[model samples]
Target chain A: MKPEELKYAKSHEWIKLGDEAVVGVSDYAQHEMGDVVFVELPKVGQKAEKEKQCAVVESVKSAFDILSPVSGTITAVNEAVAADPALLNQSPLDEGWLFKIKPENPADAETLLTWEQYQVFIKQA
Target chain B: MAEHELRRTVLNETERKAGGKMVDFHGWELPMEFTGIVKEHEAVRKSAGIFDVSHMGQVFVTGPDAFNLLQHLNANDLKKATPGKGVYSHLINEKGGLVDDIIAFCLSMDRYLVVVNAATADKDFAWIKKHSEHMSVTVENKSDEYSILAVQGPNVPLMMETFAPEALPLPRFGIVEKDIHGRHCFISRTGYTGEDGFEITCPNDIAVQLWNEMLELGKPYNIIPCGLGARDTLRLEAGYLLYGQDVDDDHSTYEANYGWVVCLDKGDFIGRNILAEQKANGVKRKLTGIVLSERGIPRQGCRIFHEGKEVGTFNSATYSPTLKKGIGMGYVTPPLKPGTLVEVEIRGRRVKGEVVRTPFHKGGAFSKVLYTGKDK
Candidate 1:
């Protein structure tokens, strides 16, 4: 997923908006995490702030926090992510999307990233 | 320090490709593992596996006072160590907690070698050097001079025969004196995986050749490369304690279930009197093993419960490939014994378990097995 289609945070979170804004971690973050096992998703209707930690992802050997990419009220979550966390390893961009939210301000994500900008950001990382 | 990617001398470039999932450990990047933990773990149990253990630190302590240096630094007695033999001991600070657990080997009458945990190597070396200045001893960090590989399993030695059969004649815990494939090599019959295996060390230049040669030689046997992923699970299955996670400088050997190595009978040494007094008075805490009776795996730092209250926390945990159950090691209030019922909190639920002996080796150490049964 291009960082431009979604917003990104320096903390490694990325968000994609379609129907509802979907949030997940970046490829850079996943690579650094090494492996993906368990993911702790925030409950439905939880309010989240930009760059705030909203969920947790666990690998076989490690556990890490997932920061929210855009401030919003979570409306629905991908239950499949929790049932089979390996989705992150398989298709991190499509079926692997984490949770959904009805953002208070969708435009607020404008400052997050552009496709080219995220590439530069990742290189800098 | 996190500039581009962290790299350290603990592991080499070839080791990075061996499924190390490189992590920055004390300024060095080393593989945590290559394949998934469960599969890699079972490989060591049922067959043979290789571990890139280059991250471990090797330090040389020499001079006339080398014996005196070891006596003052380690909690265990080193005066009885004969050449070519090694003994496990605790490197400790004044407070009696362990700085690191190390293997001290007597290389020669005046030369000694100490193998320490990679993360604590600098601290152990610095501490050894800082204290040795007044004792007429000199410490040199030899970590950069070598790369290590631990070929472990039931058939490691048998498999090594194809590559270097001459090493087979060396006794258990024996160290070879020559080079392998033209590289300076030392092979010792010891391993962290609780197997009858060798920790092979050689000059960095020949590491790749030796690894390739071992692979070629081991091809007939299905020996696969293992990473730290399997390494941890194997050690956990064997009930070995990791330095930073399972123990620290704040915990003494008396409390960690290693009193036999303390050797209080051998006159005064660092922490000897304290260990003796602790032994007499009974240490306040003890490290014990646990086998969970629930489905969930108990992991590190998980709170351990006894009855209703929180009593301890698991230091390390894993699902044993042999026992096929969740097992762990942790420190608990003293008087804890085998069959003592306890619980490990996993995802907020207290799973039932019982304290067991240090290690319950299923079918003996994984490497010592020789299949007399016909290949099925």
Candidate 2:
């Protein structure tokens, strides 16, 4: 089950809103992509548009893009995940957080699906 | 569009119960990975792993003219495949393009068992039958009637000694009919993972029984049930080509870097003339192995550049679990040398790479045995 506090995107990214939004892939996303082997994180100060491809996560089978949930400027990246990609599969919501973005409009996070709605959305998908 | 039903092997339910992630593989519902691709890959490398390869086709050619028919249809010299021995060869069309790569096991002087790729089974059967029209051979497709299980890794020989003792003395590529777990089956000392292992072919009814028995018996050796994901990565690391991916109807044996399987001096075959011509005047594009120097993964259709110019595209590529690097094979023109520097374009960014000798990981069981000149 997804954390009730986080918001979700249709492309499967999850965001925790605050002064700076923390972003990572959903558990469902990580489960669908088996055994993450490598991750390409976005650089600090880079501009990210909402729902745009901002990072790449490569599994043993294929590569997948991580879309930004809300438009902002990249603030930081999780260096731990870069060092060990399997952390994404192990703790996707916590230590596997990919990046932090200072949201252009903090209200944009509210526009995204709530945890319960995200669950229903994925079930329909 | 109409929903197309996928075919399932006899071990489908068993694989699902083992935690396999099912996926559609060429119209067949097979496991993409069981536990995980990397873990399964390592299991086969370090200890032992079992694979459900029942999707591979089996065609039997039996008659007085079995030898002649196979000899005329394939590019390899089948004369060397005496009784109980198998020969790997390419079935080429009249235009010298690959119909499929196959392993013909000489069951006897009058009978042969040809194992082919699952995707090309029907086409290969039709081609073989069409070519055998004038020959005194009975061609039969027994793919649906049988199941194949491959037990591979460094510990296979030791593991086999526990249950199938009769398979211990068999030479590499040797096959024989024996009773395994109270069921009669054909066990061949051959595998695609570059490991010293056996591929057991048994009746469909006995497959589930055999699978469960092997897994139970193999627990002492840390044997895990691997899926196609692991199988593909293992084969890539071993430098074995996938028929439809690395070799297709558009590519010839010589162009695919499989000229070693062709025996031009072995007399007339379907594509001997063209293969001979290409062998005499070298192929224009040769399949070469490329290893990335950076952290990114290389994938199929990735453009390969040499000296700032595009030269080839990756036909088959994967992140090699054993090597922990991106490696791939592709047809490059003007054949790059082993140390030649190249760049692979991944997602519009160029990554440094170099052409290298294949069998990307040389620590496989088969390599150690072959290189040390061991009699076993």
Candidate 3:
């Protein structure tokens, strides 16, 4: 689901802004990765840098890095998705959310792409 | 430096129209996936899947001395393969390093067909010609004249019954010439996948037509078109050795876990002395399968460690869809038993795993069948 309220990263990760921003890979990214078999999640309270690899997702044929969309400290992680990696392919934007980050700079969301802009950006890619 | 242009097969446009994700593979433009790797992989295991294997090379050898030439060139005993039969063999260098692994088909007493790897086609042809200087055999490369389509899985028999009647009654490793929808094709009951399947070779003009017919006949059986992505994982899970990765010029046949295919008792051939000596003593390292005990994916070039000491590296590795765990093949020091514990360095962390018997996911038709030299 392409929610207008959420921001997108060029690397295909999505961020939902709030008290604690929810971060995940977009549906398009999951589609491109094929069936995800394993997800290595970052531990809670770990600091992450923007545009840097903070997690890993492994498919049957490939392994891809899930870069953090914004610099933050990970406040929470979705253990459910880690247990069943297929959830990422089935609902990448919803129940398949990866983790929640407490951003160091709350205004970082404005630096990301809007949902409509992401749709166009993906087309060009 | 000039960029070399990539070649496309006869079914290239058809594959593109069917949603195949194209990629450059060994100088050929081909599909890496159709629907998706896992979906296509599952389709082959559960039902049937077709692959455009036209990028593979085909060479023709014909003369009164064809058998004599092949017997001296191939590592496997060529005398066992009668007409209408095919056997997998490796063409080796004088030092026992692999030149290229191939399938030799004996069409008649004086004619033989050799299918070689796409990347090594030209080199293998030149090597064969150099070896046949004194012999009267004519070696011709006919890779462009034909296209190959592989229909693989458990549902292949039903599809053959509808479209390829001649191939339906053929025994395993048997090759038969057949007319399908007015086009002549060579159908062989052999495939790289560990499932019961068929490989049909036809002229380029009718290649797309044959593919369409096979798809139509296979429709009821839920046939899906697969690409190279699934082909790699399927063969890896089946314990089949890939040429460049698993077996190459550095490793001999015995070290590659294909010692069974080598006929040491047979008369003199290329690398026979090296192979005989290796058999009498032993190889320093052997190719073995590994399955991870923890949740981690082992990748190519990953280091294998035993008690914190590096022993070898993974040559080919993938996440097995059937086993739901990381599975791989690598060259490790010998004397490592099937249950020997080891660690694979995935990414940076050491993941626990164990050396195991190959053909990781069993219960396929090819694994169960007992070949008795007869058609079922």
Candidate 4:
């Protein structure tokens, strides 16, 4: 189950909004991608446009693009996940968070789906 | 495809119960992975793993003219495959293109068992039958009647001691009939993963029992049920070609870098004239291995460049779990030597790489036990 405190994107990324918006893939996303072998994390101070490709997550079979959910300036990147990609599969929500984005517009979180809505959205997908 | 519409092996339910993530593989509902591809791949390299390979086809030929029929059809010299031995050969068409690559096991002086790729099973059988019209041989497709399990790794020899002791002394590519759980099965010391292992072919009735029993017996060795995902990665690491992906009807044995299997002096056979001509003149393009110097996965159809010009395209490529880098095999004209610098175009970006010798993961059983009979 997705955390009720977070909002989700249609592309499967989940964001927790605060002073700095934190982004990571959802539980369903990690499960669908199978094992994560490599993670190309976005850089700090980089521009992250809403719904734009910001990072790359590669499994043993193929690679996937991780899009930013909210337009912002990247503040922090996860060094731990960059070193060990399996962290994305093991603990995708907390330790596996990709990056921190200082949102350009905090109200953009309202445009993203809520936890309950994301549950329904994935079911329909 | 609907779940019910897909074909299944006898151990399909057993695999699902073991938490296999099922997917459609050539119309068969098989597990793409169990625990995970990297984990399963590591298990086989370090310990042991089991694979359900029942999707492969088995064709039996028997009669007075069985030997002659296969001898004429296979590009390799089948005469060397005496009874109880197997020969890996390419079935080439009259145009010198591959029909399929197969392992023909000489069961007796007048009977042979041919194992073929799953997707080319029907075509291979038809090709064989079409060639044997005048020959007195009975060709039968026994794909549905049998199930094949590949038990592979560094720990296979030790595991076989408790599981099937009779399989221990068999040499590589050797086949022996052994009794397991009151049923007879063919245990061949052969595998695609470059491991010292056995491919056990048994009737479908005993498949479930054998799978469960092998898993239970192999617990001490950390044996896990591997899936097709790991199988592909493992084979790629070993530099073994996938039939339809790495090689197909468009390629001949010489161009595919499998000329070693083509015995030109073995007398008359299908595609012999063209293959001999190619052998005499050498191929224009040859299959070669590539390893990336940097991060980034190179996938199939990725263009390969040399000296800032497009030279070839990848036929099969993957992230090597063993090497922790990008590796692939592709056809490059005027084949590049090992260590030659090149670049691969991935996602419109050129990544530097180098040509390398194949069987990329050299620490497997083939390097250690199969040749020296001692662990490194």
Highest DockQ against the true fold, candidate: 2
Which order, best to worst by DockQ? Answer: 2, 3, 4, 1
Question: Which tens-of-lDDT digit does each residue in A2-105 have in candidate 3?
Answer: 57878999999999987798999898889888889999999999999998999999887778999998899999999999999999999999989999999898
Any runs in candidate 1 off by more than 4 Å, and if so which? Answer: A1-59, A63-125, B1-5, B9-12, B16-20, B134-136, B360-376
What is the docking quality class of candidate 4? medium
Q: Give the TM-score of candidate 1.
A: 0.75
Pairwise lDDT winner, candidates 1 and 2: 2
Q: In model 4 chain B, where is the ten-residue run with the lowest total lDDT? A: B367-376
Q: Per-residue lDDT of B173-193 in model 1, one digit per residue for the tens?
A: 556556666667777767888
Better of 1 and 3 by lDDT: 3
Cα lDDT for residue B367, candidate 1: 32
Best by lDDT: 2
Candidate 4 Cα lDDT to native: 0.89
Candidate 4 chain A TM is 0.96
Expressed as tens digits, the lDDT of each residue in B153-242 for candidate 4 is 888778777667667777778788878778878999899887778899999999998888888888898999999988998998888889
Error of 1 at B374 (Å): 17
* Candidate 3 chain B: worst-modelled 10 consecutive residues by lDDT: B365-374
Evaluate residue B73 in candidate 3 and report its C-alpha lDDT on the 0 to 100 scale: 87
Cα-based TM-score, every candidate: 0.75, 0.96, 0.96, 0.95
lDDT of 3 at B235: 91
Task: List the pairs of residues colliding in candidate 3.
Answer: none
